[model samples]
Every structure is written in C-alpha cells, then in structure tokens.
Target chain A: MKPILEIQDLSVEVESKKVLHHVNLSIQKGEVHALMGRNGSGKTSLSYTLMGHPKYRVTSGRILLDGEDLAGMSPSDRAKRRLFLAFQNPVAVPGVTIASFLRTSIRSVRGDEVPAKEVRKLIREELAGLGISETFMSRFVNDGLSGGEKKRLETLQLRLLQPKVAILDETDSGLDVDALKAVTSRIESLRSPDRSFLLITHYQRMLEAIRPDVVHILMDGTIVKTGDASLAKEIDEQGFQSIHEASAQL
Target chain B: MSPYSTTTRSTRKNRIESLPIPSRKDENYRFTSLSNFNLQQLNPSIAHPPKTVEPAPEGFQLAACTYPGGLAIALESSSHEGLHLSPFEDAPEAIFQKHRAAFDLPQALDADLFANLSAGRCENELLIHVTEGKKITQPLFLRNFFPSTDQAFYSRTLIILEANAELELAQEFVWDGIESLIQPFACGLTQIVLGPGATLRFSTVQNWNPNTEHFSRTYSVLQEGSQLTLNEVHLGGLKNQTRHLTHFEGRNSQSLHTVTALAQNSQQMDFWIDAVHQGVGSRSDVEVRSIAQDKGQIVFNGKIRIEPTAPQTAAYQKNPCLILSEGAVIRTLPKLEIQTDDVQCAHGASISSVDEDQLYYLASRGIPENTARTMLIEAFKAPGLRGVSNPFTKSWLSKNLALTEEEQ
Candidate 1:
C-alpha cells in the first residue's frame, strides 16, 4: 500500500515571507485525509504549492504524485498528470462559458476531444446532482456565481476530471446543510480503489458526513497532530486551543 | 451620365493639390509619421484602376461589375430588389445629386490630407443607394481584390440608406502574395447616409500584405431615430490608418461603434473614431480592443462630442490594448467634449499585458500555453465582436480569427 500523494518536509513562501514550514503529509491510494487548520495556518499554501501555483514558491521539500516529483512542472502539466486542485476562491473568467471550459479541460487532459453533445449531457447530469440548473453551463466560468454555487461547480469539475489525486482547499466552507450534504454524497460517489483525496477544512461538520480516514491538525504552518476521525470530533468539542495547550504542556 | 460629374472631381482634386502634405503638426495626424508610408510616392491626387482583370486573380473571387458572388460573398445577403451596383459613371442622378452635402465625406475629409488626396484622385468609384422603406435583408459585401499592386490607387463608395431601410454592409480585403508587388499606397473612401429611422450594420476586415500601405475613411450621418452599429476589425496591414466618424443627428437615435485591432510583426495601425451627438436625447457608445505583438505599433484616438443644443445626451468611450511582447507600442487617447451642461459622458483607455491570474487559471485547467494565449485573445475580442448582428459578418470574423490563430 504505497502513498498515492506525498508532501515531504514541504515549506511554502509567498512574496519572500514563509507561510508554511516543513509540513509532512501523505495519503495512500483510496484513502481520504482531512487537514484541519485555523486561519493563517498555511493549509491553502500547502494545497496550492502541491498544484504548482506559480505565486506560491516551494522553498524546500518535495511534492510527489505517484512517486514522481512535481516541482518545476507547470500547473497545466500537473493537471495533465492527473493532479487536480479545487480552488477555494475559484477564479471568475468572465467570457469563458462553463461548458466550453470543462470540455476544453477534458480534451486537454484526456488527449481526445469530447463531442459537444456528450459534454452537454455530462454537465447537465452533474449540475442536476448538485441541485444547480443547467443554465449555468451557458454562463461564464464562475462569473458572479454565489459562493455555494462556485463550490458545487468546483465539485462538479472534480468528478468530471477524474484526477488520480484531488486536493480540495476549503471547498466545504460557505456551503449550506443541503449543499454540504450534496457535496458529501458526491465525495462518497467518487470513492474508488485507486483515487485519493486531501480535504482541507477547519470545522468537524464536514468530516462528520464524509468521515475522513485520517485527520491532521495543522497550526502555524506545520502539522502538529495526526489522529483518527474521533480526534476531529474531540477537537470540535474542546476547540483547538485546549489541544494547543495540551501539546505545549507536553 | 456620371452623376458625380466632372466639376466635383476637379474641385476635390484642387483641394488636395492646395493642401500641403500632412505632417506631425496636424492634430488629426497625431502619432502617425509622414515619412514611413511614403504617400508622396503615389500620384498625389489620382486613382489608378486595374489595367487588366485576371479572372478573379489566384486566390480571391474578384468582385465583377455584376456578381452572383461579389455582393453575395461580401454582404451574404439573399435579397436583390434593393441592390444597386455601378461603376461611378452610371450612378443615378437623383441619388448622386439629391444628397449633395448629405453624404459625410465632405466634412470628414478635412480631418486628414490623404483623404483629400484620395477624393481628388478617385476614379470610376462605386455608388450604392438603398430606397426608402425597403428592408434589404441580404448583406452587401464589397470584396476589394486588387488585380495588381503595381501602382498606387484610391477608390470611392457612396451609400445612401433611405428612411426605414435596412442593410448590412461588409468589406474584406485580401492580397496574400502580392505584398512585394505593391508600390507605395492604396486607399478607399466610403460615405454613408442613414435616413430617418434606417438601420445599418457595417463591418470591415482590413488585411493588406506588408508591401502595401493602406488608408480608409468612413463617415456616416444618422437621421432622426435612425439606428447604426459599426464594427471595425483591423487584422493585417503594413501601415494602416482608418478614420471613422458617426454623427448622431437625429433625436432619439442610438449608435454603437465597436473596433477590434490586431497589429503584429512590424505592422502599424492607426484608428481614429469620432461620435458626434447633435440631436436632442441622442446617445452613443464607442469601444475599442486592440492586441499588439512583436514590433507592432497601434494608436487609438476616440472622441465623443455632445453639441450645445443636444441636452440629455449620453456618451461613453472605452479602449483597452493588450501588449504581447517587448517593442510593441500602443498609444490611446479617449476624449469627451461636451458643450451641453446636461450630459452623461465618460471615457477610459488602458494598455496592459494578459492578466497573470487569467493565464494561470486557464493553464491550471489543462489548457496548453498556446491554447490559453489564443483563448484569452479571442475572449478579450469577443465582447466587441458580439455586437456584430449580421450573421454573415460575424461568421466571417470568427473564421478569420481562427485563421489568425493558426498563422501564429
């Protein structure tokens, strides 16, 4: 059982200031890992670095996807290698329609053009599952969409792209209960033998439904605790401060 | 039988002869240089028509005296009743003589010296007139295929749309391998008269090879309640200068001017657009989007004027230029002159490279760098191109855009 996605001693910096420090994390194939962190805890920094965002500099350490190093590779090349990132704040490209962008991404990743008819059908079915109307397919990519709608649209991409490893950064935030449920069910549906996921979130509400196989608490740019699902529930009840105090006392 | 008559041609030719060659001192000539194009090399005030027509040439389908393909290919119009085609000599008296000052070339030509040169030297030009109340559904396409660029030439087109008449006019220029054959310059003038409540959608694609310098002028006057939409697409030219003027003369009339410029390699593009609101409650909107790559140079001069008596006038002008590389130059000026106290007017101009966030976002979605670049450029230009209501013209632009992408 080899780890499908691994980040070894990873540190990330943005604009000459270090935001992440020596973070070690790995998710084996078919396993779901939840990264819990407070604000400024560098959760997003780690995820973006993994996706090869040009703005985030990987100062040290290596990001491995299926035993291959991802550093120096472009974001698009990483995407072609089946590594996907669900942006927390999705970019709004005003003129690109959702369906066209999706089809283009599919063609770029799959190395084959998907017929327009098939693309429309898939978008219709996926959007329906997320309770979003098919009209969104005609709209610009995430342009003026509600926060909840942007999250669901991202989840839709997550499924359609069928990446080997998916890193979802704060995807569950801003989602109402029904939307959260829809997203959890979609996450469940995506459960497969070879796929892996790293879900980044702070609260335990999302984990209650998706039920992560492992939960890690990241604070001040480094992972300080790695535990089972019960640990997430304990932190949710006791809050992160008590654990911080307990760890400091150790 | 020529309605234009000999007197008017000589009168314009005299104007050209008297006016010294335009220089940087002329405000309208602004950033354009008088030396690079070498307009002086041309016969200062004469239009030289083709000596021989070589069966539509090697590539393009030459616009014949009459055509199943000439007008049909350019305008993409199916109707024929409202169609009028002539070689200047046979223009009708009522159309040519009735609106003596009604056409806009007279007033617009004063802005530049070359325009006067073109008018003075023009010969055997085409004059088109659309009758009142007839909706010409078929588009009118003027496919100008220069038989040979051995000498300098200038052509003229006069269009009059009567009240309630409708037409979509398109112009496409093609001279692929004839660049070296081009001597000094080639020019054309199109004057339009939009009758009260008439509607016209005009589009132009300027693609001239590197050898020929090109200049074009379009001046249109709209009557009361008339509607006008004009799209100027500049894609290829060695040195190109186009001046467009739209006068909103009628009360309650609306006009939109959209321009798209693509200047690549060492080519130069200068575009001047003016929107004049004279009628009460008239409104106008002007927008330009340009892309300059390699050593291409581009200039956009846009102005909106609200007359003293035209109250409640609303006007806006926006020009955005995208620079793709070093040595690319862009100069833009957006001006609003409002003599009326009660007016809403605003203008903006900016030159920038492709947004990094936009580039990264597309790239992260698995789009290759080349594809992303092409996509961004197309998207940046689409909002303006979508204003093109004529199906034929829009399709032609889309096909040409793809052709440009492949050329890159």
Candidate 2:
C-alpha cells in the first residue's frame, strides 16, 4: 500500500549546519509511527523540515505527501492539505483567545469562514473532552497557561483539527500522569483508518499509552533501525545505546 | 460674572502668538513636530455655524447633531431628572466660565502647547451637568462630525459631576471630509470635574478621516472619594496628537486612564497621558497600547507625578507597542516623577515585533501569513480596549476599528 507520507532520502540543514542527513522514513495510512532518538539526534529538525519551516533547509531529499512533493510549499499551504504539528513548547498569544484562534485555523484548513456562534459551540465541545472548563476557551491562546495546560491545549488542537498527517512533537513532556493520560487518550480517540500519525519522542511511556505499529530508531540524522513495536519495548528495557551500537555494527 | 462665557479674538491671537511653534526638541513634543507640516495650508472655519443634514447615519440620528461641527447636537434624552444637558453657549455663563478656569491644566501641569491653543480659540461649548446626589442610569451620547475636509474649527466640551452624583458619557468624533481638497484641523478641550464621592465613565472614539489632523487637550480633576475612568480609542488622521492632564484634588480619588491607537500607511499618532497626584491616599492606573503597520508611526508617553504632600499614593503605568512592518515605528516611554518617599510608583514600556514562535504556531495550524499577522496584531492591541465598559460602544469600536482583511 502506498504510504500517506514519504520522506525519501531526506536531509535537512539549519543555519548552514547539516542536522538531518539523508534520513528516509515513511508512514502508511492509519499507522502510528514512533521516531525514537536521544537528545540532539535531530528529531525536532525533521518535524520542522517536514512542515516546511524556513530555517530547516532541505539540503537534499524529497518529501512527498500522498505522492505530491512538498518542497517550496509554505507552512500554511502544507496545513491546508491537513498536515498539523503540535509544538513541543507552544507559543503564547495573549490577545487571540482560544476560540478565535481555533476558528481561524478551522477557516484556513476548511476554506470556509465559520460563524462566531458556531465556532464557540464547536470549541466548547473540544474543551470539554480535554477536561478544560469553558473559561479556558476564552483565554488568550496559551497565555499564562501552565506547562501542562499548554500540552493539553495542543492535544485538543490535534483532536479538533483532525489533520490527515499529525506530528506530535514531544507533546508528552511536562505532562504529569493525569495530563499524560488525558493527552494519550485524546490521541487514542483520534486514531482512525485513513489518518496517519508521527509520534516524535524519546520516551517509551508515550508508546505504552498509544502503541505504534512501527518504531524507527533515529541516530545522527538517519533512521538507523526499523522494527515492529518490539523494538520500542527493547529500547525501553535496554536504552538507546544498545540499539545505536548494534546499528553501528550492522 | 461671565468673563469666560466668550473668548475674545484678540486674546486668542495673543495666546496663539505667545507660544512658539512646537518641535521634537521640546520635552513634551519629543515624539511629534509641528515644523514637519505647513501651517500655511491650514484652512480656518467660521464660528461654530449650525450644520444641516438631510438624513441621519447609523440610526443614531447623527446628521442633525453634527451640523456646524459637534455643537448644539441634541442628546437623545436628557429626561433623566438629575441630568442637566445644555448647549455650551446656553449654560449659565458664570458656571461655564468657572469650569473654563484652569483650562490650561495641561500647560500648567504638563507644559503642553495644544491645551493653550484650545484655551485660546474655543468658541463653541457644550456642557453635561449631573446634579449633586443624583444618579443617572442612562448614559449620555455625544457625536462630533466634521463633514468638511476643509475645516479648521475650535470647540470645547465640559462635564461637571456634582458631589455624590454618577454619570456615564460616550463621545465620538467622525471625520467625513476629503483630505486632498481640504486639510482640516480641529483643536478642542474636554474637561471633567468630579465632586466628592462622585463617579464618571468617559468613553471616547476618535476616527478622524485620514486627511484630517486632530489636536486636543483633556483636563480631568477628581475630588474626595471620587472615581474616574477614561477609555479612548484613536484611529485616523494624517497626523494627530492628544495630551491629557488629570489631577486628584482630594484624598482617596482614583483614576483609570486607558487608550488605544491604530495607525497604518504613513499615518502618525501621539498619545500623551500625565496624571498628577496632589491628594493623599489617591491612586492612578495608566495603560496604553498601540499598533503601527506599513510605515505608520505611533508614540505613547505616559507619566505619573506624586507630589510631596500626596502620601500613601499609588501610581502604576504600562505602555506596550506592536510594530507590524519593517518601516513602521513605535516610540513608547512610561515615566514617573515621585517628589517624596511616601508613595509607590512604577512605569514600564516595551516595543516588540511579532514573535516567530507564535507565527509559526499559527501558520502550522493553516492560517496564511497575512491572516496570521492580522490576528496577532489584533490580539496584541486588544488589551487597550479591555477597560471599555459600555457594550454598545465597545462592540462598535471592535467592529469599526478592526482592520478589514485587505488592510492587513
């Protein structure tokens, strides 16, 4: 089956330094793929490059979404095609409240201006599912939010947006057990047959909550190992050193 | 008894002549200049002549009131028993002239030039008086429209809140003339005098047409246990400057000064607020926000003065500016002058561009760059309108002052 997202021989550079070198990976439709790596292993660089971040230059490689190359496409254009990235640390916009921001995002994504009345109803439902009170919907986007609140807000976006290919960039960090449970449950509820997900994390705890169909060990800007869910379990037990060392000898 | 009931032409000429042209070199004019524009282009208007309008706009019955400028425009209802509404000229000359006393508070308190101009030339006046111990449930609405772009008119507005009285006032100024044909100028004074234990909410919306230039002075004095709220939204003009002076004359008086300005496409705006704490145990809070996009320029200067005798005073000020484009400029300065150690005072100012992280976050959510910029700018400036208590006026401002999609 054709993959929904294909990163074929992809390499990315930031500020003239090569951070992702000839990295190649792909996610089939409806599959949750976990990318595990140590710190500075270029996990975030890959996510940003895939979303067409300007600073993350594509030195050499082809990134295709449903067989269409995304090179030179702006982030918004990429998003309109139903691609979404939940940042590791979301930015706080004090004056643009949650309801308004989400309404704007929905309009840009759906190419239709939703009425303010309807937008409020739509957001209230999402806020409830995340255990957030109605007042949260009126707050400036992430303004004065705790770290845990920011993560839940991002997860709420992931569920509300319903992107075709969603990238979760360390959305688990800073989340306590309850928040972690809430975020993973949201991810679980959002999984579907046509949707694909890229879970970028160094922790197996996230995978324990929402198991990935496939796991790839990323080291030094390349996918050094690809295996079934067992590989993630093995990394959890033995750590990434054994995997990277074994991949080096391979 | 009515010495101030009328301003003499010779006196006006002397006042205008007494002051030298203001320049950036002056401390008060640090962010604005009169030398940059041609005073020769100024087109003067006759004494507040009555204007005739065939039909009213916005269902507020505006046309009838905007004639000959904003003078003699009938407020819909002064039927509320304690509310005393009279034309500035028809008010008791003694009281009218009495209120005009110390009209140059800005000049005395802030060393301003515009206050002196309005004091020197004002001919048309309207007074809204709230009688002592009376409460007005209905807010009084005043509208000023300069239908001609080629006008240089002088006008004044005075509001007197008697002791223990309550009042709500909303005033709007709409410039409806062509800039190229007639470059109009309007200099005016708005004074509010609050008696002991009185409260007043003053809301102003200034959207002078881009071709028009507006310069004005505001003087507000508060007595014992009184409270004052000033909410102003300014958007318009080729260039505009507004200076305000608020003095707490009695202990326990409180004042909230809120202002917002939006300028785009070569427009220039200056908002200066100065508050003097002369009464012990008085409090003053000042908040200002401005947005300048596409070569527009914005200036905000907010200062709080605590006199030696004003012990137990609290003064706080915050000014935040958002610049939307490369050429756009914002100069914000929050100052404090504490004469004695018996008071607590603080001031801060910041000018910032859009944050990249926020932009990327919005973009990744499918918002186009231009739309994202508009959303962020609106959010950045929304705090300026937070203190507006009137729903009708607040929503009107939120809708009209909002930049259309293309303007972004």
Candidate 3:
C-alpha cells in the first residue's frame, strides 16, 4: 500500500545548470513506472540525483526510500540499504576484475564475506541468466565492453544484487531486438510484490515488451503528464507534441 | 689550484695508493652532493666478527651456510669464488675484481666510522648461485642485523645464475635500537647467463633505523634469452642512497625494475637506476613510485639507454611521486637515450596529490575522508606491488604500505 520510493519537489543542479526542476514522482510496490522524455529532458539526471551522485547537487528536495530519508546518505550507504542504479555510461575501473568487484560489492552490502566459490557461483548464475559468457567475469569491469554488452552486464549486476529499488536509465536504448527481449524478460522476472523500479527511457518499444503500470511524460525538467499504460500507447501514436499542447491547455 | 694540489691527487700519493679520481659533475651524482656527507675524511674503525651467530628474524630463512676458508661450499657460493670480501684487501684477479675496478671504487665505498666497524665485525659473506636448469621454490632470505652502534657495517654478496635458472632472492636490512650514527654499505654483483631460457626475481626491503645512513650498489649483467625482475622497497631511512645498474649484453633479454620509497620526517633518500640495452631485441621497463610525508625529501633519476647496434629494442620508464604534505619534496627525472631509430622508448613522470574526484566518489560511499585517502593510496601503489612474483614479498610490501598509511 505504501510507496516504494518518493521524491518530493526534487530539483538537481550540475555545475550551475538546473537539470531537474521541482520534479515530484513516486512508485508503489510491484509497479513498473516508465519515465518518458526526449533528449536533455532531465530523466537521467533525476535517476542519478536519486542515486546520490556527488556531481549532481540537490538544491532543494528530499528523497525517501521506503519512508526513510535518503537526502544526504552516501551512494554506498544507499547501496547497503538496497538502492541500486544502472548507470547509463558505466565508468571503467582498470585493474578491478568484474568478479572481484562484484564480490566486494556483495560483501559490502551483505556485511559478510562470501566464499570465493559461492561468489563465483552467484556470478555464474547471474551471468547465465543474462546470457553473458563466463569469460566476462575475468575481464575488467566495463573495460572494452560494447554498449550492448555493458547493458547486459548492468542487468547482471541488477540480478545479482537484487536491490529493493532499481533505477535503470535507458538500459534498452542500444540493445538489439534479441537483447531487448532478454533484458525485458529479466526485468519482468524481477517484478515482485515488494520490489519497485523506475525505468527512464525515450522509446516506447521497451514498454511494449515489459509493460508499465504507470507512464509519465516529462519535458523541460518537469513532469507534465501522468497516466496509465494506455497513455504510453496514445503518446506512441500522437507523439509528445500533442501531449505538450494538451498539458498547456490544463 | 695546481693540478697535483687537488684532494684526490694528494690522497692518492700520501694516504692511500692509487685512489681513483671521480669527477663530481657526473650525471649520477648531479642531484646528490657528496661533499656534505664527507665520506673520505671519516675513517671508520674496523669491526670484529660477532662472538656467536644470531638467529634469523621471523619471515626469513637461511638458505646455505659456509665456514671460514672452506673449499666445498654450496653451488651458489661458486659465483663469488674469487671475490675479495674487504675493499682494503688486495683485489683478486677474477671476474668480480674486474667488475669492481670498472667503477670508481673509493668514492662508492662507505668509509664512515660506523660502516668500517660493521664491515670488520660482520665476517659472514653470502654467495648465491643459481645453476642451469634449476628452479628454487622458496625465496632466499638474507637478514643483515646491525645490533651495535659502536661500529659501521659493510656486507657484500655475489649472485650468479647459469643458463635456464630461475630464482627469487629477498634481502632485508634491519638495524635495531641504536642512537649512534651508523653507515652500512652493501655491494652486490650478480651475473646472469641465460641458456636459451632463464628467469630471476630479486627483491630488497630496506628498513634501516633513523640513525643509519645506508648505501647499496647493485650491478646485474644479463646474457642471451634471460629475464630479470628487481623490486626495491624503502620503508625507513635517515639518509639512504642506492645505485642499481643493469646491462643487457645478449639478444632477447628482458628486465623489469620497480622501486617504491616511503619516507617520513627528515629522512632523505636518493635512488639512481640505469638500464643499458646493448643487445638487439632486448626490452627494459623501469617504474619508480614514492610517497613522501612530513619534511622528507626523495630524489629519483632513472635512465634507459639504447645503443645504435641495439635495434628493435623496447624501453619504458615511469616515475610517479605522491606528496602528502606541503613540506615534502620529491624530484623525479625519467630519461631515455635512444640511438637507434627502430626502437620503442617512452618515459613519463608524474608528481601529484590525491585525486579529488576519487576522494568524493569514495566519500559518497560512506567511507570517511581519511579512509578514502588510504584506499586511494593503496590502489595507486597496488599495481606495482601486485607485479611482485613472491607472495611473501608481496605480503611484506602490503604490511609496509599499511604502516605508511598509519604513519600518515
């Protein structure tokens, strides 16, 4: 009955440029909320701000995860609290293998050292679920991986971590049809009564595969419209110009 | 300023017979001023051998032992069959004598009062030989203990490896609690002849006390198809200077040299490394990393020279220094002299503080600023330490790094 994540009057600024202006959003448990916006529409900024990126300053607002204030909490602390963000552009950390990084992340979040064999098993299962090869575990994290491979790796982390709230920013943007289907199926499998997701994307193609309970149209750093799944289809047919006109009339 | 009135000329004729004249303006001694140390004036007292042999420290084991004037020594002792143990004694007519004469012996010698005393007292010299087609499972650990402050110490080691020999040697220099000034000199000459395929890993951990001024000179000659790796970790010193030179004479030889220095307080450290590639298809890599805090000062000059005859050679040198305090000073000069056009040679030197972005990233993860800084330092130094082949040496380096972090 309670909202899984609540952002009240969230405004984010990066280096004197206002990216997100007074954006209010909430997603209830078991609900797939799609945040639709054009390029530079502040959708990714909202996701990063919620995840506590140091570069994104919250000028005024509060972020609540399961009713607990996460306004000033660190990204690692937030991660420990089961908050995960699938970065749109994942940074490559040299000399840190994917296996070791995943093991460290899991141990830091779980507060217990898992055996190497168990860690390898979990990584294998997660990678297999995402259709990633075993060789991916030995490579450096996000190093020399293609865009589609990086996205799948993000999904691999999402599956392995199983965070309470996942903010996946355009994870299906560059994915092929098969990859899109696999990624969508992975997201669909993670849908649970106690879990929530904030999927930020510009394409309605992803929504057709993994249906959303609610769809919101955002323009110029603010959310303009909120409606049901039919709204996504309506926008797919009419485009965002008609929605802008309709919102202006209101 | 008469020609014969110079210090070297007068000393050569009156005090000592035929002292080699060393030019002070040499590039090797450019940054370091030897005038202040005054090595020639302080005549150290001779050291007597210890009454009883002391047990080695923890994490260290003795490989082979030889009594005084013994014919049937270990195979490793054969390399130094004709090496003179003392500089004051008449030089032998062996390969080691020729190698010693090639350098300015008197200037390189540590004749300080304490060094002479320790050299006279420490009679146990080690000779390590790596036979052809032989691989040592454990690292040969040599512990040189300076328990007395009344005498200076001088130790010499001769290491040789035949073709296809692989070995790891770790030497630790420790000076117990002493207030008197001590100068310990260590000179090591290693000849590695690689028959088709051979590998050698050498690591040194110098933990001299604040009162000791340590000087070490190491020269290694690699033959055809050989590989040599050297690692130096300097954790403690008052005034320390080390010179390491590697000459690649045979084709297809390779060398990787890494030096890590962590200095605090008023300690001064200077390191000079020169790698000469004389053989075609040879490769050389040099990396020097240092961390200076308090008022410590460190100077590192690394040079990689490729001869005209040595075509198709590859050489890379990098020296990076991290200054933790405003008072700390670090001077790094990474030089490359390539005579041949068909060579891949590059050098880089970076002197920087901690990265602010990485700090913020770690802090946002709930790690405190100090803890984050430590993590970043560990990450920066971990690359060089991970390349260590010996697990015990790697662990030892990790322990030293932790100690440095705590001191900071």
Candidate 4:
C-alpha cells in the first residue's frame, strides 16, 4: 500500500521569516496522523504550505499527494484532487448562500453539474450528519455563524467533498464537548483503509477522543519525535518541556 | 419633420449655451471633472435620420394602460398624461438646467448610425402609474431597438408612482446587428417619485452592439419614507458611459445603488454613481464592481454625500475592480462627504488581481488555473449582481461570467 501523502524536507517561509525548517512527514493510506505542536511551532504553516497557501512559500522541498507533485497546484485544484483544509478561521463570503457555494465547489471539483435537487438532498444529509439543521444550508457560508457552527460546517464540507486527504487545522478549537464528540465521531466515521487525515492540533483532548494511529511532535518547523498514540498521552501528562528534555538526552 | 427635430436643431445652439456647468466646487460635482467632455462637438444633425421605424425585437414586449377609446386615443392620452403628470417636468427648471449645462447632451447623445433609420421616429412610451397602496405583481419590461446603421434615434420613458405605491421596472437596451458601426444615443430621463411609504425596484441592462457607442443618464428621487433599489448591468459596447444619480430628499428615505461592468477586448466603460442623502435620517449604500480583460479600460466613481440637515444619516460607498490582463486598466474613485457629526459615512476602493490562495484552493480541487481565476472573478462580481430583480437578466449575467467548458 502506498502512502497517501508525503512531505520531504519541506522548508517554508512566510513574510521573509523561516517558519518551517527542514521538516519531513508522511501518512500512509487510511491512517490518521496527529501533528502536535506549541504556538508558532509551524504546524499550521506546514498545513497551509501543503495546501499551497500563497503566503507560505516552499523555500525548499516537495509535497506529493498520491505520487502527484502538489507544490504548484492551486487551492482549488488541490481541492479537486481530494485535498481539503478546514481553515481555523474560515473566510466569510458575503451574499453567497451555503447551498450555492457548495454547488459551485462540487461542480468545479467534479467538472460536472450536480442536479439541484440531488445536491440539495446530499447537502441535507451531510448537514444532518454533522448535527446541523437544514435551515443552516440557506445562510451565507461562515457568515454570522458561531465558532462551533463554522467548525461543523467545515466537517459538513469534508463529508460532502470526501477528500482523500483532509488537513484539518485546529478544528477542535472553540467546539464544546458535545460538538467535539460529534466532530470526533464524524472523523471516526470517515476513517477508512483508503482515506487519510493530517490533524494539526495543540491539545491532546481531541486526540484522546479520536485516537490517531501515529502522533508526531512538531517543534520549530521540524517533526522532532514520532511514536504510537502513547506519545500524545505522554505529552499530555509531562508537557512539551519534558519531551524537549528527553529529546536532548536522545 | 418631427416636432422634436424641428425645435431641437433650431434651439440646439441656445440650449447648449444656456446649459450651466455646476461649478466643480459644487458639492455634487466635487472630486469629478464635470466639464471635461467637449460638448461643442455634439452638434444636432438630422441629415441621416433613421429611414424606418422598426418593430420591437424578439424576447421583449411592451404594454400600456388600455383606454376605452382606440389605440390612437389611448396613445395620445397616455403621452399627454405621462408628460404632464411627471413630477420631474414640474421640478424647478434650475436643477434640470444645471445638469444640461454640466454635461454636453447632444455630444453625449448616442451617435449610432443605425439610429438614423428611425430618425424622427418615436416609440410609444409606456406610462406606469402605481396608485397609493398599490403593488405591482408583474415586472414591467421596457425594451428599445435601434435597427439601422444609417441614422440616430431617441426614446423617452416616464414612470410615476403615487404615495405608498410599490413597483418593479426592468429596462433593456438592445441594438440590431448593423453591418456598419452604429453611433446611437438614447436620452432617457426616468423620474420615480416614491410617495411617502412607497418603494421601487429599478433595473437596467445595457447590452448594446459591440460596434456602437452608447450614453445614458438615469436620475431618481425618493420622497420621505420611500426606498429605491437601482441595479445597472454593462456587458457590451465600444465606448459606453453611464451616469446614475439617486437623491434621498424625504425624511427617512433610503436608497441602494449597484453597478456591474464587464469589459472585454478593448471595450471602454465609464460608470459613475452619485448618491445624495438630503433628508434627516436618510441612508444610502453604493457598490460598483468591474471586470476588465484584454486591454479593456473601466472607470468607476461612486460618491455619497450627507447634508448638514441630514443628521443621523448613514452612507457607504465601495468600488472594487478586478483586472484579468496585464494591460487592462481600472480607475476607481470612492468618495464620502459628511457634513453632520451624527452621520456615519465610509468609502473604500480597491484594485487587485486574483488571489493566489483562492486560486490554489480551486486548482487543488481539480479546476485548472484559468478556470479558477474566472470563478474567483465571478465570485467577486456575484455580490453586486445578486441585487438584480429580473431572473432572465440574472441568468444572462451568469452565462456571461461562467467559465467555458474547454477552459474548465
């Protein structure tokens, strides 16, 4: 079985500041990987760079999705290739209804128009699955939505788009325990032998709920340590300082 | 000779001379060169008047009030009653004279050669009267056709609504395919009076022939407690200039103005919007969006003014331009003038190319780069186009902005 995504020596720079040094990580098909890091540790930068954010320049290295070079592809193209980034702060596109936006996205990604009735049915099912009401589908995307609602909306898109590899940026933030549970269950349901996830987060609470197959501690742009899901529990109990000390000894 | 032409040419010189250019210092003309266009060159000429009065084109219809008498009587009475009942005809001549003076009417008039075929010809003007407490169910469609390249023609429209009346009007401009370039000018002054509690939705589609140069001016006045929404679409032209002005004169009046200009392949468009909040508690919102490609040039200027007496007035103006080609030029000026401390006024102007992140986001979704750029541009203009009330017009605009299958 081939890896779903591979990041080889990915060095990223933003605004002339080196945010990600020589970093490397990979996720095999159907695996859930957790990228844990402190504030300003380049976890989000790495995700954005992989998603081809204009500001996050890949100073050096390559990003491959299913053996296809994704360094120069656009976010939309990346999205078509089954790549999704549930932004920590989703942009508010005023005057665009959620239904219309999703319809456009589906058409652009699939290169074919989905009948309105069918799309509506699909959206309704996806919204229900994410614990969102049908009324939410008529409102503008991310406009005036509560933080939790926005996160669920992202999950709704994940379910609708069914991207092969989803890089969720801090989706656990701002979600209540119930919302977190729902989100975790949705992520768990999406887990399969062919689909993969690169969950970038700072807290271990979410990981405890949706246990990942592998946990990588990212610090200063590089993945300093990789281990089984126990690594998350160790970081939760001992904090990152102990990990830094242990790495120094190693 | 038609009465209009006989009187038009003889009085043309006097009218041009008597017309007053409101001083550039005037609050309305401030920040705009009101007299930049040379009006003297626009001499009234009837030598090549339209040879025939062509029938209305396809996809358009016109209907007027049905009187007990024959069509002639109905037409005559309608024209007489419309012209006389117009509040604009009763407005202080000083205001009309001011606009006439500042802008060269004849020169700015469309010079399309096809207009000559219908020269001295007059189409039956549709008279719409919304009585107090009356609401119109069907949108009135006014379509004008200039079928010949041999001459110039003129069309006049008058719309009046009584107090508490609600109406929606859609006006479309279409030119026949002329073998030669057409220079036609349509002088339209649509006067809408919202009696206290009245509301109106007015939309215009200016899709002239690509070989034609078109000019038009639309002025609207809102009475106290009345509301107005004006949507303008510009899709075709060699050289097109349009001026849309809205005045909120009654206390608590409100106005929303939106303009979308899509220029491609060396087309030049100048779109100007002027909104005046003159009554206390009056509010105005203006938005202009333009997409220019292939060395196209688009000029967009939006102004909002809050008078001193209009305390608690709120006004906002936004002009954003998307340039798809390196050589395309977009000049945007968004201005706000507030004389009352209690008023809220804000203005923003931006000229930017496509966003890389947005592009990448779309491309990664399997959409190519060019298709992504086109989609982003459409998204950028969608906000302004959403206000269009006519479904056909909205779909037309969508088709114009959609990415081709090959491109996708």
Clashes of each: 9, 3, 11, 47
The residue-level lDDT of candidate 4 at B242 comes to 68
Q: What is the lDDT of residue A204 in candidate 2?
A: 90
Assess the local accuracy of residue B146 in candidate 3 as a C-alpha lDDT between 0 and 100: 56
Judging by lDDT against the true structure, name the best candidate: 2
lDDT of 4 by residue, B305-342 (tens): 78777898888888887888998888877767777788
Q: Evaluate model 1: give its TM-score.
A: 0.91
All candidates in order of lDDT, best leading? 2, 1, 3, 4
DockQ, per-model, please? 0.51, 0.62, 0.23, 0.38
RMSD of each: 4.0, 3.5, 6.7, 6.8
Model 2 error, position B126 (Å): 1.7
What TM-scores do the predictions have? 0.91, 0.91, 0.79, 0.79
> Which pairs clash in the backbone of model 1?
B45-B121, B46-B121, B47-B121, B74-B141, B75-B139, B75-B140, B75-B141, B77-B138, B77-B139
Find the 10 residues in a row with the least total lDDT in model 3 chain A.
A92-101
TM-score, first chain, each model: 0.95, 0.95, 0.95, 0.95
| lDDT for residue B54 in candidate 2, whole number 0-100 | 32
Rank list by DockQ: 2, 1, 4, 3
Query: TM-score, chain B only, every model?
Result: 0.87, 0.87, 0.76, 0.73
lDDT of 2 at B357: 74
Candidate 2 runs further than 4 Å off? A111-122, A244-250, B6-13, B36-44, B47-70, B76-78, B93-112, B403-408
Residue A145 of model 3, lDDT score: 92
Alpha-carbon runs more than 4 Å astray in model 3: A112-121, A133-135, A230-250, B1-36, B40-61, B64-126, B131-138, B148-151, B177-198, B210-212, B264-268, B292-299, B320-331, B350-375, B386-408
Model 2, A1-250: lDDT tens per residue? 8889999999888999999988889899999999999999999999999888888899888999988899999999999888889888788888888877877788788655456456667777888888999878778898899999999888888877788999999988999999899889989888999899999988899999999999988998888999989999998899999878887898
